[model samples]
Structures are given as C-alpha cells and as structure tokens.
Target: MNITDLMWKNATAYGYTFTRTPPDAACAARVTLLEWLDAGRINPAVARVFPLEQAAEAQRHLIEDRPFGRVLLTLAR
Candidate 1:
C-alpha cells in the first residue's frame, strides 16, 4: 500500500525525512518543536520534564545522553 494514499492522517507517524538539528539551527528550532508537539502535528522521539528542584539531576542525565530529548523544566507554585 502507498503511504500517500492515507491522505496525510498518518503524516506525523510516517513518510517524512527528519534531520538532526545543527548547533546553528537548534536554537531557532526549539520553539517550533513545542508548537508542533502541542498541535499533535508530529510525534517526537521522546518527551520528558523535571521539576525545578530536580534540575541538577536532569542536567546530569542529559549530559550523559541518557534521556536524549527535550527536557522541559517545570515550575511548582
């Protein structure tokens, strides 16, 4: 079966090529990620968040590339 025949409802799940963001492009692309994810337009590789108090632990995991994706820092109030 041809993917294009699905009429794009499976667009986010298949039939596209994604590139690794270069350092120069990463900063500009960050906001776009949130926009797309929130709109359910793309299925990200991973999504994780940590509260402000656990920021240090989150940084450690990120530096080790353990949780290798966007880590949202959440606030508690």
Candidate 2:
C-alpha cells in the first residue's frame, strides 16, 4: 500500500528486483513454460478434480472448502 511496503519492504529488502517487461516477453515465457511441461519438469500439485458438470460444486469447494493446491475442472467424459 505504502511506498516503503511496495518498493523497499516487499522488493529491495527481500533482495528481489521487481520489474516490468515487454508484452512479448509473456509469449516467450509461455513458450518456455510449454517446453518445461513437455520435459516433465513442472509438476503441479492437484488437490482434486471435478467434471465440467460439477462446475458449481467445484466453485463451491474452492470458495468454502479451500482445498490446498489446484482444483481442476475437466471436460473429458
């Protein structure tokens, strides 16, 4: 909220350089992410999976239950 919190405390104090990059960088980052996924390097922790039909239930679970990790909604039958 404050300048100290935004710049010094959150960024500089932690030794992290917060910066903004060009929009094209996002596309390149996505490509890199896909490459990592293909190489089986990115293993996301899945909490639970819900079918598309159970979208409401999934949302409710997310809002109320708040399970750890990702709650995936799949369209596959």
Candidate 3:
C-alpha cells in the first residue's frame, strides 16, 4: 500500500498519535523506516508484549528466556 494508506490504516488500527516534530537525524531515520514499512520491505518480529507495569518481569524474561524476537512494552490506555 502507499504511504498515506498505510499510515491511515495503522493510525486507525493501532490508535497512533502523529507528531509534527522538527526534522533531525532521528526524524529522518524514522521517516525512512516508516517508508520501508509502508512498502513492506521488512517484517518486524515480536516475541511478546508486557504491560508497562511489568517492566521487571519483562526484563527477567529477556535475560532468562532469551527470546529470539523483540519484547515490547505497552502502556495502558
């Protein structure tokens, strides 16, 4: 899908909050990554998501479990 469509879909599906920060190195990198995602050039692997309050547990899981993919932390809405 195109960048506009991908961004709209993700914003609606994931409750994304778009920001209008000034351009910098990080912003450029983020834009590039979003473009790559929009183009389906890369697939992110997620191991598991832990609630924000369970950060210690998540860290333990990372150290002990050694998961093959990323361990994410999500905020409660």
> What is the Cα-based lDDT of residue 56 in candidate 1?
93
lDDT of 1 by residue, 1-77 (tens): 45686666654443322366576677667677779889999875555788999999888878876665577779998
Kindly report which residue pairs in candidate 3 clash with one another: none
Where is model 1 poorest over a 10-residue stretch in terms of lDDT?
Answer: 9-18
Clashing pairs in 1: none
Best by TM-score: 2
Per-model clash counts, in order, read 0, 0, 0
- The candidate scoring highest on lDDT is 3
Give candidate 1's whole-model lDDT. 0.72
Query: Which scores greater on lDDT, model 2 or model 3?
Result: 3
Question: Model 1: runs farther than 4 Å from truth?
Answer: 1-35
Report how far off residue 43 is in candidate 2 (Å): 0.6
TM-score of candidate 1 against the unseen true structure = 0.43
Model 2, 1-77: lDDT tens digits are: 25677665465433322246566886687788789989999886788999999999999999999887899999985
- Candidate 2 CA-lDDT value: 0.79
Give stretches of model 2 more than 4 Å off: 1-21
| Clashing residue pairs, backbone N/CA/C < 3 A, model 2 | none
Tell how far residue 71 is off in model 2, in angstroms. Answer: 1.1
